[model samples]
Target: MKRILIILVLVLICTQIKAQRPMDWAFKLNLKDYNVKYSLPKGFSHLDSMISSYCRSDWSELFQYSLINTEGDIAIRFLMIPITPKTAEQLEYRKRLFNLSELFPPNQNYLRTIYFQLEADTTNRIAYYPKAYAKKTFNVDVAGEYDRECKIVYKGKFYKSKVVFLHKEDRMDCFIHYFYEEGKEEKVRETIAKTRGMFRLR
Candidate 1:
């Protein structure tokens, strides 16, 4: 019985070790892993502030951008910006999605914001995450939920995602959205796990 228990413990440890993705990065290879020490790009504070204030939720601990390196001569940057709008006017201004079925034309990512509807005061509020998802097509991969309301997208070989939490408690009554990488089903599961823990639908 002692030997059997010991073997079981060993198996558990081995499984846990394999489950965690390694902390790794390479020169000009930003997607190797996630690094959060860096400050966000300029021109993003107002948007971030608006999101936090509108939702009345703290977003400093929310998902940050993961830099990815590329072989292309032109500069390519990639990161997920989570955001929400406080007012209807603000929400309308953030609609930045344009179609990119063509790549040879070299489409730059539309720096867009996905809004979440929530109840605040007598007025309804929309919140958003602020970060741009930009990158070269070959270097990174992106998948998003483009619907009537919520839009979610993640980029690159490593698993990094952006999401908006929608609940049926009060004001809004429509879309619920979550985004992830196209082929990265495993990573998407991990993202959902983290999402459920840190976010609230209501």
Candidate 2:
């Protein structure tokens, strides 16, 4: 009877170990060259995969993965582009051009308004770990928008959107586009902060 009780206790311990396993992520990617892995945030669910198939645009080629909250009010769209030597050179040239443009107020304003529709409160060059080459978070005023699936859910209501860009030289160039309503900036900021922990490199 003592031996039988020991086996029962061992089985119970094994069952508890399995129950404590980590939560499964909805999306995961392994970049062999970089020796890094990427996973979607823990709380978010995978956005519909079909959305990527139908969306065709210049940036569409870069689309990789996406996630959305249960309420559907908040979403994250990820884009990744491989860095090439020629592209790196072009990026440097663009930086120089931007610097030159900043010397002229009219040119700077024009570029900002036309490209970003940026709002008054913009934060730039905030660093996050595991340390990307550059990181920028900013707000933009945009017209009514649809979700990745092109559904008319958010139509007719203007949106204040947040955009985050993270560039890791020779490894990854990624954009995380965040969509949320007006008063949820604080929540979104917290989510952005969590991204630092989500990505890691060997």
lDDT of each: 0.28, 0.47
Candidate 2 lDDT over 1-202, as tens digits, reads 9999999999999975554332112234324544555666777876643343312232224335657777666777655444555654655576697674432132122223223323222344222333223232211111111122222223233144455654454454445556676578787777766764454444
Best by lDDT: 2
When summed lDDT is taken over every stretch of 10 residues in candidate 1, the lowest stretch is 46-55
Alpha carbon deviation, residue 8, candidate 2 (Å): 41
- Model 1 C-alpha lDDT per residue in residues 1-202, reported as the tens digit of each score: 9999999999998875554323112212332222212233222211111111111142222332222222211111222322223433334344433343422111111112232222222122333322222112111122223222112222223222333322221122112233333454464455434433221211
Q: Candidate 2, after superposition: displacement of residue 95 in Å?
A: 16
The TM-score of predicted model 2 comes to 0.47
Point to the candidate with the largest TM-score: 2
